[model samples]
Target: MGPAPTVHAESVDFVMLYIVAISVVLLIGITVTMIYFVFKYNRKKGHEPVDIHGNVLLEVVWIVIPTLLVLSMFYFGYTSFRELRDKPDNPFIVKVTARMWQFTFEYANGKKTDTLYVPLNAPVDLEMKSVDVNHCLYIPAFRIKEDIIYGQTNHLYFNAKQTGDYDIACAEYCGLNHSAMYTKVKVLLDNDFTKWYGGNWQPVKNGSASN
Candidate 1:
């Protein structure tokens, strides 16, 4: 309804809105056309059913237009996915471990917490995995989700442009207590985050500030 909450969220929103808009336009157009034809060709008016040959132009137009629309949607979606896979040179990495009904966020400094704490406007990369069964980490505000499977790792990253708390839920339906599998992302200011994260982590040689 409003602007994107994170840097990559806008890209996802763009692709989503494009598909939705196209679907709505086509839906209305087809519905209107179908109704008009139904009433115009009513049998009650004694309209003769003519065996007419199909028009090549009309058939080609329908086929080509739908094909182009599908290709365009795939293009937008693929580009957005590519952007998500590109990691920064000096990203702040967080290990996200999911189990039966809980999530744990481990920072570089070995500090673990249930609630994710990230600095505002800073890029955060998540390395996610599950201990037992499969799970999925979903953050609607950030428009990011990744599967957490045992013996495999998944990744998702986002830059929090806004400062506040956002809900994080498990989209995958696990065993009992799945409804309670939720957490919050607390976007803190730099000073506050530094205090929570302790001192400086491993230094970076990229001429930029380190987490």
Candidate 2:
């Protein structure tokens, strides 16, 4: 009922809502219809089954309705996907290198960190590449997940609206320590991020590396 933490989260939420709503409606409708049919046509009632051989109108209605529904779902899904795929025009870029079990983020100022740091209410673009095998960068709070392929460049953009730490995980299993491929994204206010990025502000430790 409320907006998600990130800007792109709203769009993802909308798509998910649409899908869940449609699924619930269909489930209820089918359940109710089955119950009613069972009771109405019970053998105890001495009722005879009526044949509905080829009702053209019914056939057309079912076919057309489902076709339209599938098309609509596909359209909305594709639209939301495109919104994530297209990179921001001028986003704060960070280079991410993913290896067997660790993530190395290189900021514009040449500062590297094991964890991610971003500014609130600002668009940040992550350019990711895998050093050896396949990996995935997943931010659950932001609803952004993209694969990091070896020798191929992949990227995704997100705008953090809240100032807090969010979990980041490698969605793909790369090696033996794939589960250890975890980190946190620290979001700070505009001024604090500026200070930290400029190497002036010291961030409080939250069990992960900040520098």
lDDT of each: 0.87, 0.85
For 119-191, candidate 1 gives per-residue lDDT tens digits of: 8777788999999988999999998898898899998788788888899999898899989999999988777
Off by over 4 Å in 2: 1-3, 199-211
Query: What global local distance difference test value does model 1 have?
Result: 0.87
TM-scores, one per candidate: 0.93, 0.87
* TM-score, structure 1 vs. true: 0.93
Off by over 4 Å in 1: 201-207
For all candidates, the clash counts are: 0, 0
Model 2 local distance difference test score:
0.85
